[model samples]
Target: MSCCTPGSSRGGNSSDAAAVPGPTWRQNTTATASGETVQVPVPLAAGEFDMGDNFGEGYPADGETPVHRVALSAFLVDPTAVTNGEFAAFVDATGYVTDAERYGSSAVFHLALDPSDTAICGWAAHARWWLEVRGACWHRPEGPRSDIEGRRDHPVVHVSHRDALAYCAWAGKRLLTEAEWEYAARGGHEARRYPWGDALAPAGVHQCNIWHGRFPVHNTLEDGYLTTAPAKSFHRNDYGLWSMVGNVWEWCADWFSPHYYRRSPQQDPRGAPFGMARVMRGGSYLCHDSYCHRYRVAARSSNTPNSSSGNLGFRCAADDSSLSFGDPAAPQ
Candidate 1:
């Protein structure tokens, strides 16, 4: 299911009837991981790659129409979504308050909700599984009684797009542009459904953490998770980016536009000039083919800049100029 409520932008769409092969380029460098912050050194092919899903391969979303080509510049991105530990470090260093904290409330998944508090919480009118609770922030993802505890390695959720920007600014980085995000998520693959490939479970091996059994009810935990998994729990894509498809919905550095792809620039497109909701990509653990099949690499989503939820989080990216090129193996 979509992370944001209605009025948020939908996924990018395409008019192309078939998948287009991506341009080929020599790989300059691959990604590397460190203790907690895993930065991937992406050497983009830099020419053209199919940017949206064709009719039959992806879910039916009007925003995901008009399959088109988009070019992106080479950039460095975090291999994994920012973890709670990393966010905590940023908080400790800057004493910055997140939007969820400032607002004293956030949207939480119903499965993660406390049994007794269910009656008091408000549910999303469209997606009843989403519960709005006071005191639900990144640290207290499930609400007041919840804490990071052993989930330090898990992707930090309940972070608004503004909160993600603050973290990026503090780290001297920026959020990935929607094109950049799709490029990185594709992970050197061309027109594939996921970072790995078209098969959701290639060779019957679960590659990412996503919903199992059913959505909003009875998650069998067959993927070894009920909610969010550790940021690095799954196999990294060709670019060594982890959890690019499933885990949490990542915020992107672009405003929402249903037809942005129609008029988007051919070179390093920046997304809609201005809009109310910001772009978000990657389906979260709540995704199910029966409901939201947006976990596909080319799929897209969006939410208000200040909207925060248990399934929402982000990673950081830096321009190639921002990091030293001395050691390719060194983390950014």
Candidate 2:
């Protein structure tokens, strides 16, 4: 986890690592039927967008291990992530209990030190994270101290894959498949490093709200944010999607297998037959070059679907035309 940044490229020297900006918020222009229910309105994201790397600015991880081609018809997607307000609405509407809430705690990065000692301090955790912190659920981001009263626009955190599944079921949408996610992220272009082209950071333009200067100890705020920013803080990709590379590790629908790419079909390969963990992509705001540079488009990561954290969240997706999930009569 410390060795990978969400969007870092290992090799394949790129001359255009400064072409496009990172994902920023896109407008929620699609209108929805008026309803008192707290529902996410998804829009038709039509056209066949390319998936996987072409410029060699991505990592070769399982699932993303192979650089394959896929042609997907247009679909609909939520303009932004599922927000605190939205999740609250879901919980209110249904007695759904998130895994984090049911377990009574979740993993937190334990920055252990003697406080008086400077020898064990570093951005990259010298040891393993996933410390079991009691009362560490989504509502209480910092263990009963934080609340979502003023963060309605921020993406919801500490939700499990099952929770996301429930939300999708109730909202008349579903989570984006890994291939679909990449296609939407790329807009219409072949993969470069990010949702944008081959640029890590464009000159004079701060793309994603990543960290700057010395991490942990010193933060320069070059991206106008020390922590996470509003969902719309940076520029959108060609597909008009925001923060596709960073902010949180979005959970995809596919089960993970590091060797899945080796057997990935070119048409619409989902993932392995079965696995314990699900795929997490786009890295997160915690991403740093000195640590996890996994924000790259082709990079793949896996985690227990039930685990949650401050640096993880998700969005929703819908279908375009009259079809959903390849079935013309699929329910919306």
lDDT of every model, 2 decimals: 0.75, 0.61
Total clashing pairs for each candidate: 12, 17
The top-ranked prediction according to TM-score is 1
For model 1, how does the per-residue alpha-carbon lDDT over 1-332 read when each residue is reduced to its tens digit?
34443222222321111221221111232222223433444444355688888535554443776788887777878778888987887776667787778767778888788868743356677777787788888999899988999998899998877678777766667789998998888877787888888788978899988888956679988889988899888787877778998899998988888878778888888988888678889988888888678888878777777777888899888877666665455322
lDDT value, candidate 1, whole model: 0.75
Candidate 2's error at 24, in angstroms? Answer: 28
lDDT of 2 by residue, 123-179 (tens): 323424334445656676545545666666677777767777777776656788887
Off by over 4 Å in 1: 1-47, 55-62, 330-332
- Candidate 2 deviant stretches above 4 angstroms: 1-50, 54-63, 109-131, 321-332
**TM-scores for the candidates:** 0.86, 0.76
